[model samples]
Target: MSNRVDELEGQVAELRAAVNGLTEELVETKDRLRKLEAEAASEAEPPAERETKSDDHVVVVEQEQDDVDVATDSLGSDTASEAEPGEAAVEPEETTENDTNKSTDDIIVA
Candidate 1:
């Protein structure tokens, strides 16, 4: 009976060691997986992604400003037309078309 108990105890100890080793291996695998995922995410974001994101923001800002200008122009026109006599009503035109021209004149000294 004592020998049987000793044998059972030995089996339990072996199982515990195996379980500990397996737990350690699982943890290491999970850490490696997390590192791989992070690397993949970083690699997936190319320079073009950043440029597209910046262009999107610029477009959104330009659209919002255009909307505001349209609103203000409409309001001004309404007020101007409602004004009493003797005022010369002038319609606003695109005066500075050159202002929108992007010239790559600045040389980068590197």
Candidate 2:
């Protein structure tokens, strides 16, 4: 009976030590998980902040497109005004008098 009690006590002490070790490991693992989560959060930027940056980029692109369109329109108007008025005129083939009066040199001028 005495030997059996001693064996049982030894087993109980070993089990208690194992439970303590498991509890300590669990606490450490939880701390590590918390630290990892915090690091991940610090590295990440919020979606709304990223969207604001993208919105700024979109505005800049739109402004550039508007400037380019304005510049092209002004350039086209300037070139059109610079063109000679007589050269800008388009006549139909049915305008018989002008076609007949045209010199051969002028007909092939283009």
lDDT value for model 2: 0.78
lDDT of 2 by residue, 1-110 (tens): 99999999999999999999999999999999999999999998744212223564463223345567888999999999899877856776566666668754366643
lDDT of 1 by residue, 1-110 (tens): 99999999999999999999999999999999999999998888433212224564463223355567888999999998799888776997865656445343354667
* lDDT (Cα, 0-100) at 95 in candidate 1: 50
Model 2 per-residue lDDT at 90? 75
> Local error of candidate 2 at 15, Å?
0.4
Best by lDDT: 2
Please list the Cα RMSD from the true structure of every candidate, rounded to 1 decimal place: 16.1, 19.9
lDDT measured at residue 108 in model 1 versus the true structure, 0 to 100: 61
